[model samples]
Target: MLRALIYCLAPPPPTVNLVSNKSNVVRGKTVPNGTVSIKINAKVYMGRSDAKGLFNIKITTLAAGTRLYVTVTDKYGYTSKERVVIVVDRIPPAPPTVDSITSKSKVITGKAEANATVIAYVGSQKIGSAKADKYGKYTIKITPKKSGTSIKVVAVDGSGNQSVGKIVKVRP
Candidate 1:
């Protein structure tokens, strides 16, 4: 008499989760489509954002301290930006680092030689970018999708130097 033995092997499905800094109601409704892409170490994971800005992507394999990159695009203009240094481990990643910001009505004088670039961010989401001149002057016209939002700005030099500034509150 002869007997045979059988073995079973299969890979598990990936797991996904949504991440955000703050939760609030916009225009009398909740924003749910703020999801971002997550990467494990150096591998890209399949994920997507929901209508409420929530995302939960699963991976067949996962490792600790995986470096993650999150990016969201402006629905109107389709301009996209990626946040650097986003890490994913057993714990969630820290908030985005804000450098500097200024919100004055007389900052821009309708000049054409402005060379300075203004980068704006609300929490971890990048809202817009602007340019200034040699006099360290810039103007950014921001129309927030939601109410009661705040943003930060960073002044970057041509030599790759970043100067920290104050945070500005936005009113709808």
Candidate 2:
């Protein structure tokens, strides 16, 4: 009597977390002891999954919007499909610089990161928001406030990172 053996053709793809510009390593999960490969900017990095099926690969820090491709190969020489990840910007943009805010003024002018969204707040209430131009200039329209009213402004980058607030006091 003769017996036939069936072999698995490929391993399952690895699961990776969301990567960001602040990340210096790529971490993911695959088959236990499987070989893991990461490709970023056409450069390939190799690593191995631990007994718990978790793997981490150290590589050069990548900028926001960079793309990483990952794959896994099991001990049976079966390779998985490629996984794609995009790095997000985790670093906040610089605080916006605002012009004078007077009691009679209806517009707020500022400079911030190019294409970032600038938001103005009075206490905890949002007043106005605008997107900065290519030159990092923005103007937000808001209702006039009384003298000594404090207006706080912040810049939010494309990746949703928000900077510390810049406070301006409304003058008479």
Candidate 3:
């Protein structure tokens, strides 16, 4: 007699969803179709506009805070207007000039000592806060509800100026 065996295989790879939102808009009245070009990270990905003044493009993979450029061409054969510094990252880039951030024992440190007065935002949602100390230091602690979470931070000065920094990746 002969013996038989059965085996099971893992599932296929998951699909990557492309999420797009209105990055920026150029103001004009007589803007014609094929007059606009949407550039992501300094690369022209989509050109021309539809009847509704809307254009859609898919991005396979993009890091957080990817800067975007939108340009509009005038009927007079000239670059009518251009919008720069538009970011495509779901969460905006965190503020720069962070004195330092330290993580320990599943708890992050350095928000309070940085003199941070407001909570940082990642797409309109506050993730963390850091308040400045007498020595101009701030401390912030971040603990994600789930593992492999990505967050952004922005710091504001007393003069109301904002600075952006890199995205913070949390490891489980």
Candidate 4:
């Protein structure tokens, strides 16, 4: 009598985590070292995964928001699922510019990222909120306070990213 044994074999799918940093940089790593590539409009940036399957590639300054496609090729010639990385305008709109501050009227005008949320602050108290128009202009009304009181206007993007505060000394 003769008997035969059968065996089954297959490679596991690799693991990958794509991350974006505060500096607007994206980095990713794979479970197993693999080759990676980032596709731009008509260009490709390639990098080889390290022993730990980690790699980073800095995207050159983009003119505007861009969509990035990344893929990793494993040692076994298997490619990872494609990932789409959306690089929004990470750059917080410029710090709000205090164009005018009328203490008596309790109104403040400023310039910020167009359509950004602008808040008028009195110390820790939030007094007024306005959305900058397309031209990055905004006029917010708040309550009048003591003279010499310092008020600040801060702009925040849709992503909840804050901009530097524009401080003004109220001459109430």
Predicted candidate 2 versus true structure: per-residue lDDT over 1-96, tens digit per residue: 122222246777899987889898889899999999998887999999999999999988899989888999999887888998899889999999
CA RMSD for every model? Answer: 18.1, 3.7, 20.5, 6.0
In order, the Cα lDDT scores of the candidates are: 0.41, 0.92, 0.46, 0.72
Off by over 4 Å in 4: 1-25
- Candidate 4 structure quality by residue, lDDT tens digits, 64-167: 45667788777766565567776655557678998645557667887899889999888898999999999999989777767787888899988787998988
- The best-first sequence of candidates by TM-score reads 2, 4, 3, 1
Ranking by lDDT: 2, 4, 3, 1
Question: Each candidate's TM vs. the true structure?
Answer: 0.32, 0.89, 0.33, 0.77
Which candidate tops lDDT?
Answer: 2
What RMSD does model 4 have?
A: 6.0
In model 2, what lDDT does residue 95 have?
99
- Clashing residue pairs, backbone N/CA/C < 3 A, model 2: none
Best by TM-score: 2
For model 4, the run of ten residues with the poorest summed lDDT? 1-10
How does model 1 fare in lDDT? 0.41
